[model samples]
Target: MAVTRWIAVAASVLSLGTLFVAPPDAPMKKTDAFLDAETTGVLGIEATECFDDPAYSRMANDRVVIYRPCEESADNQAFGFVYAPDGAFDRPAVAALGWDRCGAAFGKLWRGGSAEGLDFYPVLPTAETWADGDRALMCVVYRPGGKLPGSVLPLAN
Candidate 1:
């Protein structure tokens, strides 16, 4: 299947009866090093490879994103970083801000390509980290159903 078409199908399948509401405050885990070496100290860098949930083993919070080499086999890929707007660490509000930033970044990178099979989400800061002054939000893209063989980044000129 064409990459775009495949992405659409994968997104639809993954979204079937599934909701990704943020966990309640009581259950959310505190974390440090939300972005790994590969993801940190850089901005607008494309994923050189792909990653999955297992690659995120370093951090327990799903909102914390760590980059693993594609050769290592992982579920999601770090597309870029978005700094969270200054505010209280309200999960929904932060998420909305993150998504808006990510959307703009994605558009700049993808140039209006079909976002079907692709899933873009934010790795946000927990209240504890927020209080500790963690404001960097990791924006990632992945295929919900399986692995992506290579970087999903648009080819550079």
Candidate 2:
């Protein structure tokens, strides 16, 4: 009878442990360092504007750290902030930095692995040459149907 009781106790413990298991479907979130809004936004027009503007003839020592919100790897400083106008002209230019570029403004990651997130960054651009990591300011980032992150977590897991 003692042996039977021990077996029953063992089974109860095992069953209880299953409660802590991860759910079948859940969203994942991560945190990392990114550029502050003030500098990145200011440099958009002040540093990259036409040469005639006074904002273009200033110092190049500002610290900018725009992190493409949708990138898997955020270890790029060399790709830093490249400035450009926020108009129709810069739309393709900003896209040239790639969908994963940090200065993508309010762009978010897509939930589906095969789709691109919306780009909500706003441009105050009247410039051509931007300082590294500098781009126009974006207002907001929203997922389609209100259901996704800036970059969808890769489905490889």
Candidate 3:
């Protein structure tokens, strides 16, 4: 299957489900380091390579890419992001809006036909993060059983 098709599927999956309506634990600060740590945890990896993109350069948003050496059981090239600047990350409605924004971003990528074999989910900011001046709605992406050959930026264009 083409990679863009998989991205489309991932975007659809994100819209169709409600995996996290609220933070499961105590609210944590959503800092750059914290976002990277969260992304690493979501991708189930020890470390990741990340950079900033003008596409997501509004507010306090950030984007992260996951690259691993490679394993037969898992192909590990994927990317995710937390976007926007707003208050009230702890509110369920706010989290829902973040999810919607994330889905919209992925939908654009899918329409451009430059993505493949991906899965994604959104992460909500907590009150702590909000209090600390974090207003990002995050989406983390990964491939279920395949790895991406390169960065997702070109595909986004």
Please list the C-alpha lDDT of all candidates, in the order they appear. Answer: 0.62, 0.36, 0.47
- Candidate 3 lDDT over 15-131, as tens digits, reads 767665664554222212234323323334322232221123234354443334433223332335555555444466765665577667667655544445564445555566567
The best candidate by lDDT is 1
lDDT of 1: 0.62
lDDT of 3 at 51: 26
**Candidate 1 residue runs with Cα over 4 Å from true position:** 1-50, 54-67, 71-73, 112-116
| Candidate 1 C-alpha lDDT tens digits along 1-157 | 6999999999987897367755444322212233432333233334453554432234453333334576665566777777777776787777788779887987777665555566666667767778888787777776655655566777678
User: What's the candidate order when arranged by decreasing lDDT?
Assistant: 1, 3, 2
TM-score of each: 0.57, 0.27, 0.43
List candidate 3 stretches off by more than 4 Å.
1-89, 112-116
Clashing pairs in 3: 3-115, 3-116, 4-115, 75-146, 75-147
lDDT of 2: 0.36
Superposed Cα RMSD, model 3:
17.7
How much is the lDDT of residue 6 in candidate 3? 95
> For model 3, what is the alpha-carbon lDDT of residue 49?
34
Please say which candidate is ahead in TM-score: 1 or 2.
1
Clashes of 2: 14
Q: Which run of 10 residues does model 3 get worst, by summed lDDT?
A: 46-55
lDDT of 1 at 95: 74
